[model samples]
Structure formats: structure tokens, C-alpha cells
Target: MTDPSQPEDTDPDAEDGFYVLHLFVTGASLHSTRAIANLKQICESYIPGKYSLEVIDVYQQKALAEQEQLIALPLLIKRMPLPERRLVGDLSNTEKVLTGLGLSR
Candidate 1:
């Protein structure tokens, strides 16, 4: 049972809102590790229960990297929302990361 008039209707598929992210890393490098940590911290602190992070090791998953056309290591791609965005780096820049992910600073 649900109310069609309510704008806050609950969707099990997207209950907490959806965030599809792909983190492309070269391997178990410092940058890769930092990017993963920073992104995880940010997501958990700010957007907890509302984000999906997928870390892809380019060395192991070359096909996925090529599919995404990644030109740099440690690239973060926001795919769920419209007008997808991309950020390249270790992901230590909280302001930039938040902004790129359509979040307020």
C-alpha cells in the first residue's frame, strides 16, 4: 500500500537515493589506497546509506577501464545522476569531490 500523492514515496530500489560510482585505479598504489579511503570516509560521513561505490583495479580489470575510457589513474566517475561527472586525482580534495558529486560544500 502507498499514497500516489506523496512526494516522499519510498522506493526499495532507491530508498536512500542512488549513487553509482566507479573508482578506477592502477593497482595497489598509494594514490589508489588514498582515493579509496578518502572517498569512503566522505561518503560515510556525508552521504551514508545513499551511495554505491565500485572500485575497479585497472590492472586486473583492463576491459572495464578501457570501457570507461579512463585516461588517468584514480579517476572517480559519478554515473547514476544525469549529466555524469568525473574527477581525477587521489580524491583528497573534499570540497572539489563534494562539488563534483553534486553535494554542498
Candidate 2:
């Protein structure tokens, strides 16, 4: 569970309507590595400095992963900007990711 007393618990971009994303991964597996690279590229291209991504390694943060109720690795959760979204996969499909992030119409 996240401590509300911690500064990291607060969202910095909530006021600006930017993205607060959490990507749950497991170690250095091929899919996790691919998802990391793909997510970074997509954020840099689409949201630029407007997004905050927290890549949580499920192996290291098992409790947090369970808290998120993650059923799959390489899961992307959009936490802010209202109406949260989740995507599961290597995130190779840019169009699908963009649409999920509400970056493209």
C-alpha cells in the first residue's frame, strides 16, 4: 500500500491533465525489456515532458504488483487524466497504445 504521507504518493501532473502511468514488469525478460523501450519511445514521442511513468518490477515489488491486481507482465496503467486505462502486452502496436493513452483520436 502507498503511504499518503510520502511525497511520491502525490501526482505532480494531476493539475495539468498529464499522464501518471505505472508499468508493471518482471525482471529483464524479453517482453519486459521490449515493453520498457516501447513505452519510453511512445511517451517521449507523444507526451514528451507531460507524462510521469513509474516502471514497477513485479519481482522486486511483489506487494505493489499484488496491490495493482496485475494479472500479466508488461501491463501499462494510466492513472491520471481521468478514466484510468490498462493495456497488457509488449506494447509494440503504437496505434493501440496511443489510443489507450488518449493521445490519438
> What TM-scores do the predictions have?
0.82, 0.83
lDDT of 1 at 41: 98
> For every model in order, what is the number of clashing pairs?
0, 0
Write candidate 2's Cα lDDT for 9-101 as tens digits. Answer: 344344457789999998999999999999999999888899999999999998998898988888999988766889999999999998787
The C-alpha lDDT values of all candidates are: 0.81, 0.85
Stretches of model 1 off by over 4 angstroms after superposition: 1-16
Model 2 lDDT, residue 38, Cα = 98
Candidate 1 per-residue C-alpha lDDT over 1-105 given as tens digits, one digit per residue, 9 for 90 to 100? 666643332233332457888899989899999999999999898789788899999999988888888888899998866447899999999999877776642
Error (Å) of candidate 2 at residue 92 is 0.5
Q: How close is candidate 2 to the true structure, as a TM-score?
A: 0.83
- Model 1: lDDT of residue 17: 58
